[model samples]
Target chain A: MSTTLGRISHGAGLILVLCFTLFPFYWMVSSSFKDQADILASPPVWFFTPTLANYADIFADEKVFGAIVNSLIVATLTTALSVLLGAPAAYALARFEFRGKSDLWFWFISNRMISPIVLALPVYLLAVQLRMLDTYLVLVLIYLTFNLPIVVWICTDQFRSIPSEIEQAARLDGADQFTIFRKIYVPLGLPGIAVSAIFSFIFSWNELLYALVLTRRSVQTAPVMATSFMSGYELPWGKIMATGTLIVLPVTIFALLVSRHMVRGLTMGATK
Target chain B: MRKGGEFVERTETRLNPGYGRWTPFWFLAPAVFALLAIGIYPMLSALVTSFRRYNITRPREGFPFIGFENYANVLSDQTFWQSLGLTARFFVTVLPFQLLFGICIALLLHRPGLGMLRSLARVSLVVPLATTYAVVGLIGRLIFNRDFGVANQFLNAIGIGGMDWLGSPTGAFIAIAVMDIWQWTPFCALIFLAGLSMVPVEIEEAARLETSSKVALLRHVQLPYLLPGLTAMLILRSADILKLFDMVFVMTRGGPGAATDLVSIYIQRVGFRVFDMGTASAQAILLLIMTIILSRLYIRLIYKEIE
Candidate 1:
């Protein structure tokens, strides 16, 4: 009786939480499929004749396609650069003991705490002066800085978790430090690096404030493009929902691909 | 674990020719240089701007050095204080609910015999986290629509009747809080789930023999393991609330008569909208100081074990 009650209560609780959490996503996606008439229905249409009109409308605008491409380029490069730059620092911090190493570690982690608004204002001015505004290069650079901390933080944990005997054995066996890092740590630490990369990609992809302030027309990202729908008077409910669905689709799939690492990644290795 | 690595490194330094003294510095240089350039340069510029009269709107004014005046102006502004106060209130109100719901859901998912359901539920939970803040804000606009929204529809179903959600101050504030809870609670649950995983199966089984009450089990066996995660979650969540911009900006543009003017939105307007770099930089600096204090505390908690 107790076990059965436990099962039932836990099962019921999970369902309720899932419903509450998934409801908005359901509304977003269903509204995206609804036609103009059903989209604005007062009772909130639970069923409707699905239409491709919203998708067609969004795709017709060349800017939407451009925004997606921009988002992809920015997110991909940011992930690549963040991992590349951060891994070595993490490895050093993990394996080597140098003076002020703790301070260095603290500095990298603390960098994550600085407000984006604080950086965005100055970076915006500098970008304008350098004519770097709205370029993928500028966005990637800014994102790299923001993402570096997570990469360093998680990968440090990953590198540390590896048995230090491996390093000692590799050194005894006539392996160079870089080679050992490349041969052993890289393969072993790939999971943590990948986690950090996922975070970098997602953060850069979804980021709005920087893209909103910096990019105007040519280099606008997907999130920025989605917000543009609201500035217009009519509020294009169908198109907004459709755009939101498309913007969220890629990241959702990407996140699910590595859901196992997500708990560790989400907390930045603080827990797991 | 580190002792072995340190010994290996010491051997490399004395015995191996390949283990150069500058190896670590070389490895760390590119990232360090990049972070310093990106982090410090902009901060220094902002610091300089805060004490000067630099409004981008009037370039002719030429960014003159006016000592502490910008700070004074921001200090005197009613909107600045009110927006900061409102954001603090938002954080205070939202954190506990997110924590409660998150812990409750995490408990459910962490229960014994929740094998397949846990994985599926956890994956679906990522959908909300993966959704961008701006998209969430857009969804907020739809969900809280006074005319045809799900919020009012649900309220009406429960005999509360339809009410304007984004048009009134209290309603709009609640709407922001609701959306924040919706987005973050899953995150809290995920963190707590990880924390729960830390409890040894043997210890838990032993504890189960002593107590049938889930509450007691959690209070005694579970909550202890949850502290580190709880601290991390609280710090990250509060910081995210302070820096919240995209959602509130998209939902109401900090409107309904300044009802949802969270600090970031307020700063966005001052810095971006008005091009008042002086006052905006000062406001930004103020936020930075507060963040520094909190993060310093969090750093101690997070690095306690690793160091």
Candidate 2:
């Protein structure tokens, strides 16, 4: 009887936790379909006449399409630059012995620890001086400090997992360093590169501070754009939720699709 | 034959002379350059700017050297101290619950015979982890809304009085903390699950056979394996919570008499909103110092464990 009670309690607890976890997401989605009156109605509307007006108003008035393009451009550039630069460094760290090797590795890892808040002022000042404000280039470059370290760190582990003999054999067959990297290492390290790329893209896509500071009108990201919807007079609840859902949709989809890979990549070298 | 072989070896050595020694640098050069230009240069510039009084509005004078005056001002400022206290409170209050929930969920998911449920659980939990802070802030705002919110409705249903979530100091702080917990608990759980997987089954089975109690098995076998993960989660989450900005900025904008204002939010306001660049830079430097100290303590503790 005690064991049966224990089992029943456990099952109930699981259901409660699941509900608690999923309710916010459900609310967000439900409220997105709600009109302003429906949203502000007392006692909260669970089932509502779903409307596409919020989404339509968001797209029509908010210029979210432009923000999406900006996000895509910035994320793409950041990912490409991070991977192109980071993969080679990761390979060097993994395969080759050199002076200050451990120091170099630690230095890269420590870069991740440096808060972006510290660098914000200088980056702002620099952006103004260079006249790179509101450009995709500046945001991508600013994102590199955080993203590159992660890429190199993740890729280093991936490269180290591959045997050195494979690269050596390729080199022995008159393959140049670049050739061996392209033919052997790149193929082996593709998954790591994919994980690193996804992380870089997500970080850039979600970034708000630099986007807020640097861009005034032209290069605002989705997050910054979403913030502009807030006025002291009246909060546009429907539009904000609609835009919020749109902003998260891409990363959410990407995350769900590549979740298994992300889990493996993140957990790499973490257990031991 | 020996002489011919020796000559061939000599030729091979000369042909490949120092190739291995120089190859790594060639590969590392691009990443190193990027890091230096983007990472190190900006940091050094910030360090220099912290010591100088510069207003972007007044560009003609060019950042006059202030010689610790900004630091002195920031040190004495009561608001700064309050912000620091608020940040500390935020960190201490939220971290313990996040850790506990994370561990409990990880344990639940780690149980055998939950095949498809486990994957579904992971997917559902990880959705919040992938969501951006801006969206999270919006969600929190909606959930904690005074009149139309689901939270107040639930409270009313349970016969509890509805309180203003973002209108008061404690309410606003709790709202922000709850949002953070919602967003980050899954991350902590993932880390704990990874750590738990490393726990040996034999030890757990042995403990179970001996004691036949779940608490006994966890205490004797699983807890030791979980310590590293717990330490890591604590250190990482503490560092991140100290730097909390996006949610606070979105939800309350540090309102209700600056009660919810954290150090990072304060720095942003002083720096950007007020355009007190030197004061802001000094505040940032102070924050950086505190973070470095905490990180060092964490590293030392982790190293002690390893040793």
- The per-candidate count of clashes, in order, stands at 0, 0
lDDT of 2 at A81: 96
Q: How high a TM-score does candidate 1 get?
A: 0.95
Q: List the residue pairs that clash in candidate 2.
A: none
Task: Quote the positional error of residue B175 for candidate 1 in Å.
Answer: 0.9
lDDT for position A93 in model 1: 93
Residues A203-245 of candidate 1: C-alpha lDDT, one tens digit per residue: 8899999999889998899999998889766577988899899
Clashing pairs for model 1 are none
Per-residue lDDT over A141-192 for candidate 2, one digit per residue giving the tens place of the 0 to 100 score: 9899888888998898789888777866766677877777789889999988
DockQ for every prediction shown: 0.69, 0.54
Which tens-of-lDDT digit does each residue in B107-182 have in candidate 1? 8888768788766777777877878999999999999998888899899899988879899999999998998899
Q: Highest TM-score: which candidate?
A: 1
Model 2, B1-307: lDDT tens digits are 9999999888655443335777888899999999999988887788788899887777788888989988898889999999999988988988888888988888877776445666678677768877888778888888998988888999899999888998988888888988888888887777777777888878666777899777777777888888877776777776777777877788888877897898888888888988878888888888787777766665555544321
Per-model TM-score of chain B: 0.94, 0.89
